[model samples]
Target: MMTQGTLVDATIIEAPSSTKNKEQQRDPEMHQTKKGNQWHFGMKAHIGVDAKSGLTHSLVTTAANEHDLNQLGNLLHGEEQFVSADAGYQGAPQREELAEVDVDWLIAERPAR
Candidate 1:
């Protein structure tokens, strides 16, 4: 069976920071990022899912502050006919990377005020 498309996105997972001890104070692999007025500390999981069947096809974990587009290349399976991503994955650099491949890129349009 031929794979239809790949849906790409990322989500942050918060790390617990309840202890005062140096080693327990924070997770070494996790980091912080500010979105709007809130600051979050944790890691981000970048994922790609099959658009037609809703099955996960790829996953990559990175520090919280890592940008979403940085993991785009790793999420592609080379079998997808197209790729769909969010606004966070838009821009020239990302487009250039996609240009190297033969799949169609479907990036969401960012709302303008």
Candidate 2:
């Protein structure tokens, strides 16, 4: 059966700091990303999975500083009935992209409280 929905998310994987190394240099591929008040330094793993079956369909890696929505299009196969993502993907550009592909956007909504 075709995929009914796609779930998209991103996680930060920490790496050793360059300053602590002998060369005092960091991995250029790794970068810093801030979520709320906290900061994380590493690489970002962007994953797309079949929501109903829980099978991974795609993955895209990038510097931690990259925005999740920037890689959203790459995660889709254009066969899902809808796409669900975190609130970070709730924006005009993202919505427009989903619209272009004729997929329903199911982005998480922020709580009122």
Candidate 3:
């Protein structure tokens, strides 16, 4: 059973840009995206975790270029009293697809540099 709070996050799974298969072509499912000062090519793994237990409850994957916010709706289980995420998900509550979701959002703010 899942808890009342859910934590969501995404990570970039780096892949080599060089193609090794017989086709000699890069993976069609992976794409390049810039993070900080580096460029990464691969897929992004979006995960939803049970806050109380720290166990994963959901997962979604997309091309590296996909925005983390795009997968927020799919990571919810509909039973959460609150949802927590990093600064990448800052506007989750205002996203049209999630407008009707009543959970309290605990999105983090980007730290000042």
Report the number of the highest-TM-score candidate: 3
Best by lDDT: 3
> Candidate 2: worst 10 consecutive residues by lDDT?
92-101
User: Over the stretch 11-113, how does candidate 1's per-residue lDDT look in tens digits?
Assistant: 9988764523576555667888987699988889999999998989899999999999888989988888988988887772346666676778888888897
What candidate 1 gets wrong by more than 4 Å, as runs, is 18-25, 92-97
Candidate 2 global CA lDDT score: 0.84
Q: Each model's TM-score, in the order given?
A: 0.85, 0.85, 0.94
Off by over 4 Å in 2: 19-24, 92-99
Candidate 1 at residue 73, lDDT? 88
What tens digits encode model 3's per-residue C-alpha lDDT throughout 1-113?
Answer: 78599999999999888855678877888999999999999999999999999999899999999999999999999999999999999888888999999999999999999
Where model 3 places Cα greater than 4 Å from the true spot, the runs are: none
Better model by lDDT, 1 or 3? 3
lDDT of each: 0.83, 0.84, 0.93
* Pairs that clash in candidate 1: none
